[model samples]
Target: MALYDHLGAHPEDRDGVAGTRFAVWAPNAESVSVICDGNGWNPGSDELWGSSSGVWEGFIPGFGPGDRYKYAIRSRSGELLEKSDPFAFYAQHPPHTASVCWNLSGHRWEDAAWIDHRRDTDWLKAPVSVYEVHLGSWKRPKDGRRYFSYAELAEALCNHCEQYGFTHLELMPITEFPFDGSWGYQATGYFAPTSRFGTPDDFMAFVDVCHQRGIGVIIDWVPAHFPTDAHSLARFDGTCLYEHADPRQGYHPDWNTLIFNYGRDEVRRFLTASARFWIEKYHIDGLRVDAVASMLYLDYSRKAGEWVPNKYGGRENLEAIDFLKELNVELHRDFPGVLTIAEESTSWGGVSHPTYNGGLGFSLKWDMGWMNDTLRYFEREPLYRSYHQGELTFRSVYQFSENYMLPLSHDEVVHGKGSLLNKMPGDVWQKFANLRLLYAHQWLNPGKKLLFMGCELAQWTEWNHDAQLDWALEGQPYHDGVRRFLGDLNRLYKTHAALHATDCDPKGYVWISGDDAARSVLAFMRRTADHSRNLLCAFNFTPVPRPNYHLGVPVAGYYKEVLNSDADIYEGGNVGNQGGVYSEEIPSHGHKHSVEISLPPLGAVVFDALTGQAIPPRPAKAIEAKALPSNDSKRPR
Candidate 1:
């Protein structure tokens, strides 16, 4: 039962008694208390006389809406800690003081007139190619120590993403993490967004700007574990409370964090409510659960003897699974269009299937296998040995993950992992060729897409949060052209029917032509033509320009260039396809038409349905090339 269910806050009320009410769940301690600026109670006048299922509920007579407060949690040891702000949405300070009180209602949304991406199933089904970025590091202001404001970022970042044609922005867990460098994987307060960015309204303003521009916002929410800090939920009532009392039950070895006792109703409510807070209060479009795989296993980072087992003595943590299902069901029920994504990298069965069908119920899961297989293939030194490796080990898994996001997230660009382009081996030309092939394959492969920041622009440096993306790289033809190419790709993807959701149709994407699985050269077609129409994407990964390589087209007549990744302006040698136009007659293959033509070397090309009005490939130039060393350049993965 709720304790102070009587008082309702009104905007005019300056005192907390009439202003608003706040509550926290802490089951272990003997007593719970509250502290604030205008406290008329001294732990005696204010009592959480509410029903005791471990919920500490109290009301202050004079505390108003903006009044800051902290929990005076009492422990068995009589240790009372002065805690940090828990529900602070917009906390901003130089140091000790963080997060501000952001009333979301304060924003004047000029974007109310914008079209919503929230209501349509078909729009939801569209292939969501996201760019997961940690704002601080991706692009910083010129002042060195400062960060870009929501308005500053809205124009540049949105334009950059929109230009690349990515459908969504998956922010690295923005709900405040303690360490600036932990990459936001560790979350402290589920109710408060990290004050590192800006004010509460600033974050909302960012979302509003994104929606107004037609891009979706997906936030990272951590329900699995939290930091072991004093201000955190670790010891609300001054006890080893919310988490399991047992060391193994409470701790995460790798992260050194306290795990949530999901079996507890109050704990479940805290997590489930956290999920609801964003979707309801902030209007966020989706959530990406961080490290869900860890949440499901009792022996997450432990050996046989060092772990806790379920009733069946299995490695699985079954309680966490139930909480996740109920949470998903309730969220979907409340807002049917709200999407839930999981960052599960385990062999957990049915992680992204329908909840009604007895599954963990997630709208999508990250295709870790795809990231691994694709990364491994691109990271290799260019070799004819690739043909044998062309068929990545993760393809079958891709078809089975139901709804999946093929992500090249923050995990792929940090520490020793290196930049995507730097991951490739070979001369610069060969490296770019490899990158072209990798991206082309990704588009053709069956799954939604996600790229980390600066990947499309070909940032040569590994990501560092303090620095801006290597914007100077944009001056280079290769990088600039690649950016443009990516934008075109996004446009084509959103405009196409077959490329949206993987489940739209099993036959949506069919790989045609070269099956030379070895020789390192891979040639294939991504055809999404049902009945009378189709679009074709073909790619060639060979190093030196293929002098008249025959590419069997899926349809005949004139197929125009919808996108070309290797035009000279895009930093390539103008070879083979010096504006070559195809207008040949193709024979019918069942219900589809097929045409055969020569392909340019180291090229990725997309064609519109009609071959007749198709734009001609550029003619080869006779000019001497600049920086033609295939060895010096590394392609962006």
Candidate 2:
């Protein structure tokens, strides 16, 4: 039998009879049988004969698509085990473990336009603001339904994403998993969409609708390990078929799951094929591989002498690296515009580099350091923020390292970490202001963006996988303000070529004032490749307003205040320049011309240099900066 032949159940016609061909690799099984509803669950009736390839094959003359089935194998130790098909196209809804036979060739796709747009699009140079979501909780059905089918989620989720100006939706793992409590990380069905959200075709419809709306769908993929459930790939045929036999190499201490035997060719193929199946069958725009650090290092979460080193006596998992490279190379070769992002936390070099250049071959890597530093900084009180200003500046030391995506992922909000809004150490008004300022900094800074779902709504509660977000709060002024601010931020990011065009290039960034910790102020300039446009971004982290803050500008004239996080519309104090500020002959911050402007309390303001036109000089009196109340006691007019 060929390598593909024995992997899972496949449809076939047996001598003029409509049926299905069942095959499985049970090298250590004393006997293997295909037991299904069609066979009256009689294991002996459909006993499969073995071949030299170690695969047991049996043809069922009447079983076709949509039939429920499972493999009953007697382990070499004479223990009977019932397991779902590893390559199952569908599965029984959770609380039921049977695999459902599904034909994949039925869905009608209407996303050719989206496909063409993606093929020609350069994601690296494009704006990629992602809204990370867990499907089960993003939104539940209103009519007393526990979950929305994929089609239902598509309409609702897609609209919300587009409305908020997110370019992509990064869904948490939809790969079939048993417990919703694990949040889909512990996957049992690699090829099947969770039956919790309708069928495989329903998922296809979801992707199709997202693509049609110019939204890229990115799914979380878990290749690091699998749960040790009896009916899963674990201990298949009573042997370590997919995982390593040794506990040191196979077991994950933290997750208590089984690590894949990446050194095995069949295991590599199985994982690689699983990755390919999602993209080829569902037309997903990208895959964000989760827990990559766990897969890359041999000593991850392990004590000394508890882990096995690679053949070269190194801690790096060489086989996993090889498999990753192969997976990336093949995906890139097949899908021209698709992206592969790694949720790798360690300081691994060359993660987003090319495989041909001896790299792991990812398109982007999450900047865990930045996220940690940022959250840590924002969580501090405004008075103590100056002491930890280094947290804000240290990331720029290696900001351009490997095309970073600054992620405030779900991992940050769950398990006592607190929600993004609650993490802000302030009174209610100040908390919302701090969150708004944080988001402003996130977008204005150099890097791509990824914010978890409820962050935009400024949810007070941490994510609960079992419940929907606080939608009733959306009508409130404060939450609506945060939502509006997010929409504006996203639009600003996408609209400005300077903000996104050179996010990965060093030339696009200029540090205007990164050393103003005492004042809790920072300013930077984002430039385009051609220098045709430049946006000056300034942040006042403290609650005190600066009346005469002088910032240098590359060009002189009128600098338009393009975006202000402190604007009243976003429920801020409405403190800012009248509309735009005028630059004078005074030189500051190493620039030829500079502007002295009023700074809002705990706000971020962006100034766009007015260029390509003659400047009308402002009256001398107009250049004078006015003083405002230093304390945040001032209210919006």
| TM-scores of the models, in the order given | 0.86, 0.95
- Candidate 1's displacement at residue 189, Å, is 1.7
Q: Residue-wise lDDT of candidate 1 within 1-637, one digit each (tens)?
A: 2111221211234342354454555555556666555564244344454355555565555455455555566666777665554555544342443333344578776554433447455433566888888877777767777877766776777887777888788888887777777777777657666666666677778888888887788998888888887776677667666687787888898988889999988678767877888876667888989999999999998877878889998888889999999989888888766789899987677877878887899888888877887787667654554554644643653565466677888788888788888887787776666666667667656678888887887767788876778888876766766676567677877776655644334565555544544434444444453524455666665554544444455556555555666667666664433333453443433325554444566677665555444444535778886875675357665
What C-alpha lDDT does candidate 2 achieve relative to the native structure?
0.90
* TM-score of predicted structure 2: 0.95
lDDT of 1: 0.67
Compare the candidates by TM-score and give the number of the best one.
2
Weakest lDDT window of 10 consecutive positions for candidate 2: 1-10
- Over the stretch 2-69, how does candidate 2's per-residue lDDT look in tens digits? 33344677777767888888888778899999888877888777998898878888788878888999
In candidate 1, clashing pairs total 41
After superposition, the stretches of candidate 1 with alpha carbons farther than 4 Å from their true spots are 1-20, 37-51, 90-104, 108-116, 390-401, 501-504, 527-529, 547-557, 576-594, 609-637
